[model samples]
Target: MKALISNKVFRIVAFADLLQQSAIWIRNISLLFYVMEQTNGDPVAVSLLNVLEYTPIFLFSFIGGAFADRWNPKRTMITGDLLSAISIGVILLFVLAGSWQAVFAATVVSAIVSQFSQPSSAVMFKRHVPGELLAPAISISQGIMSLFIIVGPVVGTLIYSTLGLVYSLAAMIGLFLAAVLVQLTLPPSPRPPERRAVPILEDVKAGFRYIRGKRNLIVIAITFACIGLGSGLIQPLDIFIVTERLQLHKESVQWFHALSGAGMLVGGAAAAFLGQKLNPRVVIFVGIAFLSCSIIVEALSVWVYLTAAMRFSVGVMTAFMQIVLGAIMMKLVEEAYIGRVNGAITPLLMAGTLAGTAMAGPLMKTFTLVPVYGMSATIILIAAFASLSMKLGGNAANTERSAVHLD
Candidate 1:
């Protein structure tokens, strides 16, 4: 904890993340309430907001990552945040002009810019943070996100209720500008390598090739696909665990999310303290395996307390898996390729998520809830076993040799 607090780079990055997350939640909830009010709770309009937010991740994540690799990490992050603030300012003007429809632009523009900024931040971490502190650093990052999950919505709602849409948008812009200023305190990034006469397309393709050659990266990519599918498969059906399985009111679902968030906060702390002593792959494997069991238990249990326990356990394992995977990925990849590697792996997760989310509803209609949940858990279990094949243990030296030769 002391080491993490003393690390100048981590402090800068964490502060920037805090500011950005504050802005995001404020923008998210404010827009949600504003749109709902304007459209009289029209489901299509509300859902469109989600589409605008996520579609950019599918469309631009890889492209942004490629650019992040080509640019200076610190500069790219600052530019992305600056662009977000500028775009939000423009949207605020539109709102002031009575073009309420322009509120959707705030979600889309930030979503698109974050893809570029996020990978740059990862690259910066890879560059500036020592490998030994990587796990704790990632744990701290996850803790911030988890903390927001629990508090962001309430804060956003309070701001929107009190100040209204225009002020909320202004607040988002202010928070973003603050993030940009905080990021400016980041240590100067190393100069970017000279541009090869290579096209960006070729650079992207090389990223694919690089991942293909690394055994650990391949395992991580595959794990992401499985985790994505498993999580997405249950995303739409979680509420059913309350309404149908436990015979409780649908509103009871909030407890599940609340417990999960609390669990993530605690789990992040545990990971930070224990990370150095644990093997990353083994941690991931055990975490996923535990999560798979929790899903099955939750799906089967009619007892509310039992189900809540499972949800909390799932959150803890999720924190462990995320922190470990992030630390290991940073450790495994060279600094030069971190952006591309991140870009390449992320799409698989997103694609799996979209695919599973699209299928979950249809599958639930066709089969019982247990069967669908079972299927998801089974996929996650497979990922757990697959993680065991990673050569991070006794053959760690061999893997490093292979990675260097491939590079």
Candidate 2:
């Protein structure tokens, strides 16, 4: 652990990533508040905002991955920050100019720019960290990221509701700017780009070919995709339980979210500590299993405190699964094609997110939070079953992994 956190370059890089992940929450919570304000707190509008934020995965992630492979991760990360900052800046100005749609479009563009950096950023951790420490380190990073997401919305909303939207967004822009500056001081990471490139169709084909041929990768990828669909329901769950199910006071909702943040902080720390001693695959299954059960517990409509407990549990589960899968992916791929691997899998995962969010909005509107939680539970169980059948029995992994993206 000392070695993991001690290196100067790794520390700087990880801090920058922490800031980067924070920006996601800052932007998301800000947008959620902005759209809710504009639409009179319509959940559909909020869900649409969620869609806008993720639309890039459907549109540009694979290309982003390929670009990461073609360029230095540091430069690419800086570029992502610059583009997102510009988009956010313009949107803030647009909001000042009385155009909410322009602000929405700007957020969408920011999402697009961020997607490009993700593949590069995903690959960079491996470049900087030693092999043995990757799992725990990634757990820490994911935990920190989840912590920000938990805070960003609650904080962003308080500030926006009090200080107004412009000031809140201004704060976000400053953070992104700071992240870019931090990224600049990192060590140079250069990978060889193909001097002669394949056609776009062929490049995409190659990525898909890799996904199709690798059963474990497919199992993991599809599992997340399914989980994403269920988890995506979260966009509306906050509002739904706050208003419809629990009929809780607004302050209670805020407090629940705060509790979730606290849970994420603790859960992430626990995963980081326990991860090194555990099988990455089993740790992932445990997290998912726990997460599914949490969601199912949520569906029972017991009470607000109970629901909060479930979400807290979900926070822990989400952090564990996220950290474990990331570690597994890093182990599974070649150093050369990590970018491509990220690019390929992201869209499928995004599709799940899209499907989940979209599905949740309609379900919550028509059915209730119970069904939404049920769906979340069902998807996770499926992932667990898939893990079992793939011969991992929820714990199968080759300690000696190769880039098995071939037939």
Q: Which candidate tops lDDT? A: 1
Against the true structure, candidate 1 has what lDDT? Answer: 0.88
For model 2, residues 95-197, the per-residue Cα lDDT tens digits are 8898877767866787788667877776778788887788777777776776776666766667667877787778778878999999888888755544566
Candidate 1 deviates by what RMSD? Answer: 1.5
Question: Model 2 TM-score?
Answer: 0.86
Question: Once model 2 is optimally superposed onto the true structure by TM-score, how far is the C-alpha of residue 407 displaced, in angstroms?
Answer: 12
lDDT of 1 by residue, 1-407 (tens): 78778989899999999999999999989999999999999999998998899899988887888888888888898999999999999998998899999999988999999989999999888888888898999999999999988898889999999999988988988988999899889999887667666787787887888888888889889999998999889988988999999999998887789899988988999999998898777788899999999989989999999998888888888997889888888888877688888888987888888788989999999998999999999999998998887878557756665664322
Error of 1 at 77 (Å): 1.0
Model 1 residue pairs with clashes: none
lDDT of each: 0.88, 0.73
Candidate RMSDs in Å, in order, are: 1.5, 3.4
Give stretches of model 2 more than 4 Å off. 35-46, 92-100, 161-163, 193-195, 232-247, 361-372, 390-407
Candidate 2 Cα lDDT to native: 0.73
